[model samples]
Target: MSEDLPALMSYLDGLPEPHIVFDMDYRIVSANTAYLREFAQGQDVRGQTCYEVSHRFQAPCDQAGESCPRARALVSGQRERVLHLHHTPCGEAYVNIELAPLKDRRGRIRYFIEKMESLAHHHGAPGEQGMVGRAPAFRATLEMALRVAPSAASVLLLGESGTGKELMAKAIHEASPRASAPFVVVECASLSETLFESELFGHEKGAFTGATSARVGLAESANGGTLFLDEVGDIPMSMQVKLLRLLETGTFRRVGSSDLRHTDVRVIAATHRPLREMIAQQQFRVDLYHRLSTFPIRLPPLRERREDIPLLADTLLARVAPLRHLSIAPAGQHRLMSHPFSGNIRELRNVMERAALFCDGDVIELSHIEQALAADAWESGAPTALAVPMVSAPVPALPGHRQAQADAALWEAAQAHRGSRAELAASLGMSERSLYRKLKALKR
Candidate 1:
């Protein structure tokens, strides 16, 4: 090796950057220390192609040799940048790669130099974060979301806190025709009473104390797209009236501005509270309730779907796995299945990630999982076994009881294909009205 090779090795060893050199035949001639550590797991892996060496697999890249990035970079003799995807034993991550052509003194390109960088804010799997549910109930809810996603109808998602209602709303936006435009989300509970209207309807210059210049609100910002109103049930009555008017007229006036601006924003509201119950109590507007419930989607609680727990846990583990898949102990899986998920998918995810923190090697043992579950259980308060006293009450044949008994006997006789109610009433020598009343009374 030349002195330059020593300097290059010193400059590049274990730097954590993804770089590899592909020979003219698209085979990996040499790889930097970072590339070796990241791709090969520090094994003696040389004389393989870029894809085979980087992914530790010995096949034609993408099932087509020439279509590979390295091969293309070599052929074109031009630097190419592309977003590549790969799945490791641990989890899935996206890599942005720049492939450049390397030439010798004869001006002939000898090899292709590959530089790759991971662009994961919080890595793991793609399309998993924004939509995190695998339960049957979640599947049903997600199916409903997918069905409604293509339409522009107003969607009202109802669920408890931390159930990913906003995520569903975004899914609807992404799958809709307005996906090409902006998707705006607003937490309706954030604004104070004074700023509520201004926040939703925008404000002109000098509209109020801090209104120095003109400002567009969320509704305007989401024009020609979807506007997600999180915790929409929290909006004040005054704002509700304005929102209804905007929905009806498709026009809104900014604060302190006489001009009315028309917008094509589609509203997708979500709340954990029971709007119908709120309407009955006069807390929520009846008309607004009806308007928002154009397509209501209720997310079922996690406890209702115990069958889907294991699948969800496995999927979550796969999502958070490191370079190699975390070997979750069978006992840990058993414990996960045994517990009732009170917080739904969000809670399960937290448990898995926390458990992964204390895990050793590639295997996450029962002890670590237990520690995570126990800590979470303690945070939410330990579950206790309580015995309820079984009381033995004497049967009192009260008037109500006698009436119900008579009705049950008559219904049983009817079920047995006995005489008609009128015939039975005649047999008992009772009036038709009395028989009808008695029969009606027992149905309750």
Candidate 2:
């Protein structure tokens, strides 16, 4: 601490933007009110390490590829700036950070002042542009998307259903050179073999019974733009060959015509099914898979990136609040985090929507979430006993003895395999939220 520390702190606290002062050791010495409010959730942050607060890392920033700005400022004896995607109390946001060193009376660098400006507001809301996450898995996927966005290569997005593959494809298009042009989406699963060619390659007048007039298909309509093929795995073998021909030559004639029309369009495809397995099973063409997957990006499921749940929930709530006039209580958020969202973002959105409708007051509580989840369970006819699969042996009927023994066995099993709540819930054939509630009740 220096004699001028008090004055410096006062100046930083008066500034509007979030700012903090850290030592060479990366310990946060002081943080402005704005910084504390945004990052610390208004908790006491004195003496906390910067890595622990910002990244929840045991080591320093440099070890995690986020080189310490203070160290850079100290070496150069000048201010330094870096862009970082950080997980904050508000959500995951891109922040522009400026690091300036403060010197002691002896001219020795004592502390570094860090001023953070949020770039998310200026650019777009987090998760608004189709993707929203800060987890390492999600970050890696986003990095890949950005790296391949500028190129005209065909991108194949692989992920589970409701993992936002279409959104990622759209992101690629929005960042590409042909962003000004149309970005057409075609759902391959909905098109039949007879109509697939006409739907994608247009149809001439009197092409078929339903073809009343000439029509331009999605591929032609997407000229000089991007064409997204959703559920590519569902395209029949006959249709796959036509799609491959179009991708290979960029030329296709409308049905019932031999015009050999040409259209320059970038192709992006997504599928939840394992296309490699399909190829091995002789269901999908290997050559077409190679062409479509020039740049393959696999999205991580929600369970794999559970740390992003808070930000995701916040973003979802923000989008749904205005329409529903309802807000989620902290308890409601906890319930959401505990659940294994099998349908990923889509499931979360549906849950929130249902909760909003069921909520009587402004704040949605645990009961509202429970009712929504129960409704889903009822609709699906999911059994409650499925929550404990480890106890497979059926107990003998001995008055109330069998039921009591089964409960004991389930409790023991839940305690043993508690490493991953999601995996445990899956093994027990129940939602993670149900498992959490059961464990909480057992504790009581």
Candidate 3:
């Protein structure tokens, strides 16, 4: 209201930090330029309080247990700082806020100061620690890995797909005594079945077709650190013999070389398939299996460890936020927990990353979760029709409606039209995509 306040506001507004003053009622008495750009919602935010504009919550700061830094600043006279946080709907964009006591010339407290410093957490890059859950199985496995990481013993990670085996292997390497050494990964399953040995062991120059020059295999590439063998179960039966021999003798020759090369490389192998079963079936060598299984660790599926969903969700949301620059909302958390993530940790990360990429604002919503759920449906496999028990006692149709005599009528109609999939979908006001999905389920 005073002419001097306008001049003072102009001066403070020029600074990069978002700053503002709030009256005793929590109303925004005045704000700076950065504050307008950061929190403004089209209309003026000056007269409104923090709660009214951002949270849309009931009552003022105290009664609401308002835990944010801005709310604390408005209440206390002392200055304080908060870590990464958001006062808006989206949680991705971060800004640290500082509050200071404001006073008039007459020595009376007129308002409080709120200054913001932008930050980037509650969202950041995933280090070697991508395993986010805090389940007992996870903790125990981590402890076991850390214990063995300092030693040079080979490790064999066994778990279903989506359990983050590669992540665990990297964590072990990073925590090991040989952290400075190289950590190389080789996908045993991806190598061509005919050239598995040449891929793992360095080939001599002119060794075979397309061999222009000599090259070091993964074992030689990771001389001192770790060599992660993903999907070890898929290693061809013939190559398994060479691998076993290399592990036992610590020496292996190139595909076409006679000289033996020795190396000290820690091997960490992972597989989703049943190795013991393969051994029994004569598909995998028993000697090779034993050599790789010196120290075995298995990761539990997400469903078996449901309690860690929230923690994993938070970790993933934080991890996903920085990459795509979007935030995950509390409302989307439930849907994430409910969905059966057959793809496991990898699925969770992919879903979250997708949500961040597709979502508009900093805050992720239910729609994002829905998008993630739909995208992963194909990977989860189609549901089996009639396998799901029908609802008991479907007696009659609605009071004034008579589309079908009973709910079963709808099922029959869908089945009858199932023959002409497209025409059936159009007749029933359903999508062709939905019809195909339903038909697949019925077949299953």
Candidate 4:
């Protein structure tokens, strides 16, 4: 049977339904064209572990609480079948999956043949827009988002920076009853206190010094739709009361206008900041926090769900590669998986974008990743020693040698210790003021 595996794969590929073969370890050995077209987007999926390709999981299906046909087939020595809600390229799909154990000459189970028949007519699973992941943490968040999408509840998204809070907010908007209405976004961090009211509630013609004509605020503009407040935690303490009133009453007066106006906008706020801590410190209003947190959803960071790294990298590459005309090599993907990704998905995107630019050929290599990581390290004041090799040769003292060495040392130290200027100065055994002076001189 092992010797005929190739012929068997060819036979399976000719079938109409999706078929796949995997070993006891759940490593996918072969997948039919139907499976590849539907799941892999026609990309090469050979040698990929089933968890990485199908479920985007780190472990076997049984470990992830999904019904494992392979386990059942192995135990009973009979065909096992189950209905599963699979995440496919088209969308979430309900499929009847059948698993039959393939035996060897010694009557030992060497592989399990999986056949999937679409049950979309039986159960329609909602598509998860572009949110990619099958990890429990990610799945939980996605479920919560989908559940709250149909409601009129004011959702508050909480997560670290670069955790795709905006994407989740958009997903909610897309899934909501007000899907046809506007989906406006307001960057709270970029909006100044003086402009916050005008930006949110709008103003009448000549209402203020800069108001030349009638203007509609984001809240009013998003009437019957969603108004996404990005970095909601950054809303000024002085303006928290105003925001609270708007949320509570669905009414607001424009800046310098006495006329009260009403809007039917759904609010979806997101922030990376710790609002509870802010409330304790009196930096943020407690009432506002409570009002905005009616449906708080926390997005998991990339580091917490490392198993989704491969799928995420592939998805990102699919979107970015065509623009740059570059594909990621196996080594590049492995390199990405090893990264800590402190900045989460945003950091990963940055690395991919940089690698795409660095790669001359169609395929991105390990060297491109190394170069991108080194450049990012330099910019962020992170350690570059690992990404970029240091010069092993000794420096010779000559005319202007001391200044040159000092510049090189300062640059290297900056890469090693990415922090405040005071910290960098202290690490270099110099006063903060002196460090500033040296930086200026170096610029000259």
User: Residues 1-444, candidate 2, lDDT per residue (tens digit)?
Assistant: 577788889998988899888887888889999998888888877798877887778888888776567667777999987656666866656666778888877778888888886644312134544567767787677667766877999999999998889888887787679989999999999999988899999999998998889999999999999999999999999888889999999999999898999999999999999999999999999999999999999999998887777677656766776665566666556556667788998888887777677665676655465555545555656532123233222122323543443345446545444256876666444577977997787778
Q: Which candidate tops TM-score? A: 2
Q: What's the C-alpha lDDT at position 159 in model 3?
A: 90
Candidate 1's error at 102, in angstroms?
57
Q: Write out the backbone clash pairs for model 4.
A: none
RMSD per model, one decimal: 18.2, 10.9, 14.2, 12.1
Q: What's the distance in Å from true for residue 39, model 1?
A: 28
Q: Rate the local accuracy (lDDT) of all candidates.
A: 0.66, 0.76, 0.67, 0.76
lDDT of 3 by residue, 308-422 (tens): 7756766776776755545555545655665567778778888887777656556666445545554543344433211122212212223222222212333544543324555
Worst 10-residue lDDT window for candidate 4 reads: 389-398
**Per-residue C-alpha lDDT of model 1 across residues 1-444, encoded as one tens digit per residue:** 223344554665656786776666666656788776666677655676666654444666657322356656656778876544444434545455678876767777766677876533212233335444334466567657766767878999998876778777877787678989999988888977668778878999998888889999878988999988899889887678888888777899999999999889888999988888888888789888778778999977666666566666666777777455776656556556555666777888888887777564565554455455555534545321001111122222324543444345445433332335554444333455876886686676
Off by over 4 Å in 3: 1-129, 321-325, 378-444
Please identify model 2 stretches exceeding 4 Å from their true place.
1-83, 86-92, 95-129, 323-325, 384-444
Q: Residues 1-444, candidate 4: write the lDDT tens digits.
A: 779899999999999888889887777889999988877888877778876776677887789878777778877999987656676886665556778999999999998888886533222232223667756677677667766877999999999999999988988898789989999999999999988988998888888797899898999999999999999988998889999989999999988788889999899999999999999999999989889999999999997887777667666666666555456666556656656787899988787777677666566655565566657666666553233222122222223543454465465555555467775554344567976887787777
Clashes of 4: 0
Q: What is candidate 4's TM-score against the reference?
A: 0.63
Error of model 3, residue 80, in angstroms = 40
